[model samples]
Every structure is written in structure tokens, then in C-alpha cells.
Target: MEAFERARLNAYFARLAAQFTTPERPAAFLITHLLPERPAFVRAVATQTDLRAVLPKPKSIHAAARREVERVTQCDPLSRDLFENDETALDYIEARAADTPLVLLDVGGYFAPVLDALCDRFSGRILGVVEDTENGHKRYADCDKLPCPVVSVARSPLKDPEDFLVGQSVVFSTEALMRGRGDIMHGRPALVIGFGKLGSSIARLLHAKGVQVTVHDIDPVRRTQALAQGFTVARDREAALTGAGLVLCATGAVSLRGDDFPHLRNGAYIATVTSSEDELDLGGLPDVYTRTPDGDHVTRYQTTGHYFYLLNGGNAVNFLHGASVGPFIYLVQAEILAGVRMLARGDLGSGMHDVGADDRAFIAATWLNYFNR
Candidate 1:
């Protein structure tokens, strides 16, 4: 939170706020993972339009953070329902749509079911959906039809900075954890699964750090991209996992499972960058895995002859162990805010669309100017 960074973020928020000029402000239901800048984003949205309900990702926000959100938004305490489960969340959204034309702002595809339900219940009343994560974009891609347009900020080229930050944080935190355990990352062979933005960055960072990095991706194009980038591309999952000291899952899709356990080298460290639990097969671990109070967030599983170390209980190791990617998340948050406004204007079509280049350029220019200043 340097002064320059703060000023730059304010500029981005201001630009996002400018996109909404309609006299009749639409009611918006936002479902997002609770992050440090969440309250500020919520306040920004409220200033432009009505914030009907906020359904934060379950277990993402703690009590103290929840209190801060309450104080900032002045939202009804009961309305802050965790949306504990998907069924409950969809029901709430359906109930709220009965009152007005609603806009949906999502971080991940947390509201996919709600959107499906609304297709029949409320139809064209949904202004649009602003989705902020790659996984969410993938979910939207699968839908045969959507009730309204979806502006996805996750795939924006403007997110390169944020992706770099995420990669740096993940590597930094992983190295710190290893160092604390008397292990060094240098010279160790590491396997990075998935060659998407986050994964590619992670692989490059790890390679730059002197770790022997191999990349594996199911997509031929992504694998070719990794090969072109000069990293060793694994022929298959087993080829990647065999003899690797560290394994990092970056594929948003579930790439590993219990059946793949036999391929892991003895005492290998496994971590995931994906937000969901399905990426790594935690269920495949023995029921008696040990958890120590040490801050590394390690869960140990001892099988027939091998031992496995799972980071952050197979959750996104970067966010859980690395302080949630620090302040760089604001860049993505800013894009999400802009996407919300763009969606509010109702100019996009019924399918998933990238955030316009003009919007991306504005954010990048604002950031660059601030950095140069």
C-alpha cells in the first residue's frame, strides 16, 4: 500500500465509477470471494447503484473481516448470509429477482446455479454478470445459453500484472515454507501442472529461481506454448509426477485424483493454485493424515511406503499461505468493478465476452502512470 499504489487504485476506481450514468440505478447481487479490498469495492458499487445482497464465498472470510465489511457497507446483518450452500444462495437470488431487474457480479462461478434458475424464473431481467475468475469463465463457457450477457475480466490481457503477482506470491510463500523446514528449492526438480496464465508465470518464476521446472497440460496448445517458452513439457501426468520434488497444480480443472497417488515420489510436496478442492485428490489420502500446528499449513499422509505433503489442505496454497496475493489483487478487483459498470450499461450480448480493450487500456495506463510518477 504505497502512496503511489493507493493513488493509482483510486484512479482505477474512479474510472470504473464513471461508467454508470443512468438515472435509474439497477439493483445488483454480488457473489465474490471476500478479499481485503472487498469492502471498498462494495462501497464503490453502492455509490453507483443499489447493492441488493452480497454472498461471500463460504469459509473465505473470518469473523473480524466480516465485521469490517458490515461496518463499511451498512448492509443488513441477516442479509450477509454466507449463502452457506449453493441451494440456499440460488433461492436467495431467485427471491430477490422477484422485486427488480437484478445485476449479478460474481467472483468465480459461484452463482452458476442461480443464473440457470433465473433463466426460467426472471429471464431477461438480469442486467448482466461480471465474472472475475478463469474457473468462472470456464463454467460460463459450458452453458448452452445464458439469461444475460457475461463480461469476463479473468481473461483480459490487462490481468498480466495481477497474474505475475500471483505467481510471485505463490513461489515466495512456497520457498519460505520449504526454507522453514530446512529444505531449499534450488536444484530441485519441480512439476507445474497447467500452463495457463498463472501456471505459466509460476513455471517461469521457478525456472528463473534455478529450480528445474517441467510443465504438464492436457491442452495441446498450452503444452506447445510451454515448450515454446523453453520449459520441459511432460508427455503425460505420470511423466510429470515421477521423481519430482515439488508438484504444483495450476490447471483450473481437476487434474489429479486418488488414483494418481502411486505416481508421486516419496516425500514429495504437493500444492494447488486452483481455488477449488477438486484439483487435487485430497480424498485419496489416508484418513489418518497428521496435521501439525506449524504455520506451513501442511497435512502429512503416510501410505504403504511413501509419504506425501499436501499444502493448505489441497487448497490454493498461494492465497492461504502467501497472504492472499497481497495488494496486487486490487488490479483484478478494479477490472471487476469496471466489468460491473459495463454490464450495467447492457450493451454486451447473451454469451461470454472479454472485457473491452478500451477498458483494459484505461486500467493499464492508469497503473503505468502511477508507477512512473
Candidate 2:
């Protein structure tokens, strides 16, 4: 079997290459989590054009995926073309001049600093950047101006289905995590922080699994929505945290912190669904509690009568199982690929935009055709 042979299993990639990629496209830069699908996406992009490099998300980049990507892109074993983090990728890309536009495809806004630099310093055409996560979009949202238009699939309707499935994956992985530890999470009191798109789905899945689920969101509207859906919303956060046997952080922005650590129920198991360690602030944990390592990916934080288990440290727990999003990841990946095509037109100007309706239709139709066939 060849490197991209795995990629060919999903017809979507070849189709994506046909529709969005062309030989004339500018050099592509990819900022992504190197899951099993990454090499597949890379192979697809490489099919019709060339890539400048592939930069893996610093923490979550899998070793196997890296090797496969190196193989798929045919990078010399010692080549500097593959990068492991933002800082390194930036160092390489910032040296270019504005002679030609650079195409960016990023996840979690990993290349925000590069984009910001392009706005003024680099003087190159950042043809555009395609952002895949909501928090990633937020990183670019604050800037009043940009060097090039950014097309975001993070907020598009195309992403809604994936959001629901991501919640399912997170809960399913949480359940799997427990089962691996010779335990089950059913009937346990679970507290889910954040009730937005992903949070709401995680809460509901936990509830359906027979776990007594409580939800907390900073937004009053979200809290009310949880209540309307028959989930518990405690009068205060401390109370909710103190009762949960399983605490899951869904809000990509604010999930947990060291100060909130003491509030967790004794013997509780906690996890998060964010891409990075930002979801749960771990720097505060040691100051508040004595820690004990509980084998792989498990840390026990406790003092006196208080104790809780933090799973996978503080990163997305589902990823521990590999290809965590399964085939459904294609939905978001496909939209992101389309964003690359749109930016090539050089018409969106210097602002953030969504994948247009026509593009969405093509993606949806292609997706249905792939599945139905």
C-alpha cells in the first residue's frame, strides 16, 4: 500500500481536488491537527497542486500521522518543509516577499500570528486564510482590518452537523475512557460547562446515556435553553461543580481553572473538548492541590477530603482514541477546502467571510452523493 492509498478510501478528497484545486494555485500552507485524516487531506491537496509545507498543531500532532505526511508529501527524511508548531512555521513563512500570494488553510487559527504579520510586515499577498474552529475565528474577529479576506467554515451551516457529531464523539470517548478504567459513567452526576453548539450536544448525549447531566454556561440565554431542554442548571457554579462525578468542559473559551478546582466533587472525573490546553487552566492546579499520576493520560488532584481525576491532562479527550471524529470530519474538511478555492479569486477583500451558499450546496450535494452511492 502507498502513502495516499488510505486517502483514496474517501472519494471526497479526490472530488475536492477536482473541484477546488488547480495546478496554477499558489503554494499552500496547512495548519492542522495531524489526525488520521490529515494525510488524506494532504494527499488530496497535493494531487492538483504544490504545498509550501504542512504544520501540525504543536501538542496533538500524532507521530504516525507525521510519518505518513512526510511520506505522502515525499519530503526528504531530513527536510525542513514539515513543521511541528506555529513558531517554527512562522519563522519559515515570514521570509517571503509579496511577489506572489500565499494560500493558507488553518485549523484552530494556529497561524493567526502569521496572518497578523501579513497585514503589515510581510508585504505578501496572503491570498486568504480558511479558519475551521469557532475559537480560531474569534482570534481573527478582533482585528478591524486584515491583509486579505478570510473565509471561515467554522460558523457555516455546513459545520452544524459536525458540531453535533463532535459532541457525540466527546461523550462516547468519555464513556470509552471510563470503560477502559474498569468503570462506567452511567447514572453518574455529570456537569457540562458551556451550552453552545458543542456543549449542548455533549450534555444531551450524557443525559441520554442515563447520566444525570447538569449544565453551566456564562450566557443567560444558554442556561435558559438548557433548562428548557429538561437539563438542570444550578443557581450557582460552585454548587454544580461540587456535585458532579464527571465534569466535562465544552466551552472552548472558559471551561475550568485552578481556582475552580476545589469546587469539583470528590472522586470526580473531568475532561474537555477543546483543541488546546486553554480549556482548563492547569497552571493553577498544583498550587491548590497535591497531585498523583494515575497511569497514562490520568492525573489525580487531591488534598484531604477532596479529590478528582483529570483525564488527558486538559486537551480534547476524544482524540486519544485516534480519528476521533470518524468519517463525519469530512463535512468540515470539505468546507475548508472550498474556502481555499474562494480565496483564490482574490475578490473577498480584507475581512472575515463564510463559505457562500452555492459552495455549501455543492458540498452538501457532493456529500450526499458520496454516502448514497
Candidate 3:
């Protein structure tokens, strides 16, 4: 990391430590999908209050991250296995919260079950939950009421940094994949579904690379935005899928499935820039005609005469191919850390909320200064 970037991170964490240490520090439970900045964030949280327990997503914990988590939780006796599923995760949270009021520091909405469990068990004892993904925000959106406030860093302006990073990684990975397969993207038509932050970024990158990009989004506003950016907006799903050389899914909702198979051009590649579940209906697809693992990061799926390529098994391709979000992830992590403090301090209402504008401005300005300097 650059000197200014590191300084900004430390400064932000120090501010969080100051805000959360006074009055009375609440026990914090961190459930995260491990990322480059997570260990540092965990260490920072520990400096302000008790980090009660950690539950990391399965396959997310690495040697370094596990070591950091162990270092932080060595004092806590209730630490358990890395949870593989929601049921087990809920059990762990319920067991741990039997004695203490807890704050949830979450990524990928992994602690959503904890929030549900708290509603029936701990009730008012929950400090709050800080969520870091749009998928997570949607997961809890339908809930009539939440036991505590939810501060969503995913909905904040800090997401611009994440979008830029994601776009770069996606473009890098996609180009490498095409080149390795003896193909080129220039002059090829590509369809990008979902014009949200990540999707929009991916579409822009594709356009810049000389690919003829057509975007299909359910949201009228997003379609308008894509049109303004000089990309064709597809009016029909089948028309978008037909004859496209590359089809990228960016909607954090299911948009592609087996039913759409007939519309796909033969040899067309399907990949996702967002969550796998959000874009592809894998279960709805026919049995794989052939499966070949391209090392451990990619898989090729064939059905009948057509083949669909999945980058990183339809998960965030950027993470698998180009490292997770690159160094810019620290900026998003900083916003999350700020949300953690906001949740701990209280006064926000129950329901999903964006990171405060002041906090968002601080993070953005810090990053801009680092880049400009």
C-alpha cells in the first residue's frame, strides 16, 4: 500500500477506536468473507472493545487470515469451527450471545442469520449489524422489522472505489481468458445484464476494449444510464442473448437460466461479475455435458452443442483471477469499519441505512488525496 493509503486506514481505524471505546464498549462478533484488509480491520476492532468470536465463511479463510483471527480471539474460549452453512452459523451465534450484548461486524451478509436469531433470542441486546454487500442489503430488505439497525456500506458512495477496482479486474481476467483460448474480443458483440454499479463498470470496460456492448437491465433508470454512456440497451432478453459472443451477468439477481439456452450463440461464453447465485440459475441448467477444471480458478461447462464458460465458477471472477478487489478494497474496508463504529454508537433506526454522508466523504477524499499525491 502507498504511504498515504496506509496512513488513511490507520487514521480511520484510530477514529473508530476513539468513538467506540467510551461510555461502554459492547462485545463484537465478526462474521466475514476474508479479504486482504480483513485482518487489519479485525486488529483495529480489537483495540477498541472485546472481539467476542469470529465466524468466517467456508473456503474464505487462508493461512494468514486464520492466523490473524486466532491472534485476535485467543482470549475468547467460545471460538469454534469456520461455519460452512447458515444453520450451523446460527447455532454458534445463539450459543455465544447467551451471555453478552453483541454487535455484528459482517461481510457478504453472513451474519444475517445472527440478526434473525437475535430477534427471537437477545432482542434489545444487539448493538447493530454492518453489512458490506448489495446482495446482503436485498436479503434483509423484505424483513418487516429488524432487531437492530443495519448500516450498509454496500449502499454508500465509497462503492465507487470498489466498482472501479472490480471493473479493472474483470477486464484483465476476461482478456486473459479469451487470449488463452485463441480468441479476441475486438469487434465481438457482448451482452451485459444488470447495469448496477459493478455491471455498469464492467460494461464500460468492455466498451473501452473495442467490444460492441449491449446492456440489458430490468431497471428503467439503469437502462437510461447505459444508453447515455453510449452503449446499446437491449429491449428483449432473447435478442440480447442471440448472436452475442460474450454474455456477462452483473445483476445481483437471477437473470440467466436453462430456459435461455436456446437463445445463446454457440461457443458463447457466460461469466458473472457478481455473485453466482444472483446471475446464473445453475440448478435450472441441464447436466454438464463436459466439465474441465482450468486449474482451480475456472471451469468450462458444456450442454448439448453449446458450451458456457464460468469464470471462477460464476462467483466474483475478479477475486479468483486478479486477486480480490486489488488494493482498492482497503477503501471499501475503511467504509465498513466506519459503519461498525456507527452501529456501535447507536441512534440509527432499525432497517437498512446507508453510511453517513460525512463518513463517505472522508473515505473518498482520503483515497483521492492518496491517488493525487
Top model number, lDDT = 2
Worst 10 residues of 1 by lDDT: 75-84
Q: Is candidate 1 or candidate 2 better by lDDT?
A: 2
Q: Kindly list the per-residue Cα lDDT of model 3 for residues 118-214, writing each as its tens digit.
A: 6556633777887877777876675667767888887666677777777778878877777777777886799998888888888988888889999
Model 2's TM-score against the true structure: 0.88
What's the lDDT for all of these models? 0.71, 0.76, 0.71
Q: In candidate 3, how many Å is residue 187 off? A: 2.9
TM-score of each: 0.87, 0.88, 0.85
Please list all clashing residue pairs in model 3, or write none if there are none.
253-278
Candidate number with greatest TM-score: 2
Give candidate 2's total backbone clashes: 0
Lowest-sum lDDT 10-residue window in model 3: 75-84
Please, what are the lDDT tens digits per residue for candidate 1 over residues 278-308? Answer: 4776564556344443446776677567777
**Best to worst by lDDT, what's the order?**
2, 1, 3
Please write out the lDDT profile of model 2 over residues 110-187, one tens digit for every residue: 566556655454445678788998877877786667767888888888788889988888888777777767779976
lDDT of 3 at 179: 71
Candidate 2: minimum summed lDDT over ten consecutive residues — where? 74-83
